[model samples]
Target: MIISRACPTCRSSLKLTQKDLFDDRYGSPGKHSVFSCPKCGFGKTIPGLNRQNIGKFYARYYPLSNENPKEM
Candidate 1:
């Protein structure tokens, strides 16, 4: 069941929508459902994602950068 989230910006009701599951912009893998406030038009990633898997996913899928080779 989809649950509505409260907008942090305006305290309005937010609705979940299908969004790109993986976000690799930061060189870390992320899986999230998109939530946007209908009233204020605010948007953000849904909360309560599995925190435990973040480290593992990042370690495995984070992109390599020559600028910070130590991170690899």
Candidate 2:
């Protein structure tokens, strides 16, 4: 399914440019898309992280001092 969003800057509809983009560095769990507003040239990730997911992503995937950062 194609998902579109409104650009925060121009209030224009953002089109999906890239789909199923994954976080290769952190390996966070989620398939995201890149959306670009044709009017404002603004870009954003579809289904952006909220307070809940932000914390979870950091806690689960983000490496701490004790963990090896290059292991991923």
Candidate 3:
């Protein structure tokens, strides 16, 4: 049962699940995995990276990744 939603930035249909990030270095069973919108190639890493930090990844890890800003 994947929760599907439209990308807020690209408006592409997003159906996210654990299987989508099988070999990811950033996500895990505990962390949330954010997949990309195939149309726009918008790769987002859904946060909650830290146990103590929640609902604040935008200010927390979003900028530190140093990856493509649009993708982050």
Candidate 4:
């Protein structure tokens, strides 16, 4: 996918690159994309991470961290 977007600070085109997961303690597993600006070298995740799906991912890794662990 062409997940790259224009840089907010420099208004430059972002380049897509493969990046490994930074940390798996809270979340994040497997490979992901890193969008970077060639002009200013600004880098960030292509997917634009958020806590939207964190509940589902966290629940899978830490069963007891859910609101109702006994339900599982």
**Model 3 Cα displacement at 41 (Å)?**
0.4
The number of clashing residue pairs in each candidate reads: 0, 0, 0, 0
lDDT of 1 at 7: 88
Descending-TM-score candidate ranking: 2, 4, 1, 3
- The regions of model 4 sitting more than 4 angstroms off are 1-4, 19-27, 51-72
Q: What TM-scores do the predictions have? A: 0.49, 0.65, 0.37, 0.49
Clash pairs for candidate 2: none
Q: On residues 3-72, what C-alpha lDDT tens digit does candidate 2 reach at each position?
A: 4488999899999899999989888777888999899899998777777678667778875757555685
Error of 3 at 52 (Å): 12
lDDT at 18, model 1:
62
How close is each model in CA RMSD to the real structure? 5.5, 6.4, 8.4, 6.1
- Which rank order by lDDT, best down to worst? 2, 4, 1, 3
The residue-by-residue lDDT of candidate 3 on 1-72, one tens digit each, is: 344466768898865544335435433234347766778776665542455554354544345555665686
Candidate 2: worst-modelled 10 consecutive residues by lDDT? 63-72
Q: Which residue segments of model 3 deviate by more than 4 Å? A: 1-4, 17-29, 46-72
CA-lDDT, candidates in order: 0.69, 0.81, 0.55, 0.72
Please, what are the lDDT tens digits per residue for candidate 4 over residues 1-72?
A: 454499977999988765665656655566667888899988887676457876766667667643686776
Worst 10 residues of 4 by lDDT: 21-30
Please, what are the lDDT tens digits per residue for candidate 1 over residues 1-72? 464488888998888876667755765445677888888888877664467876656566664643454666
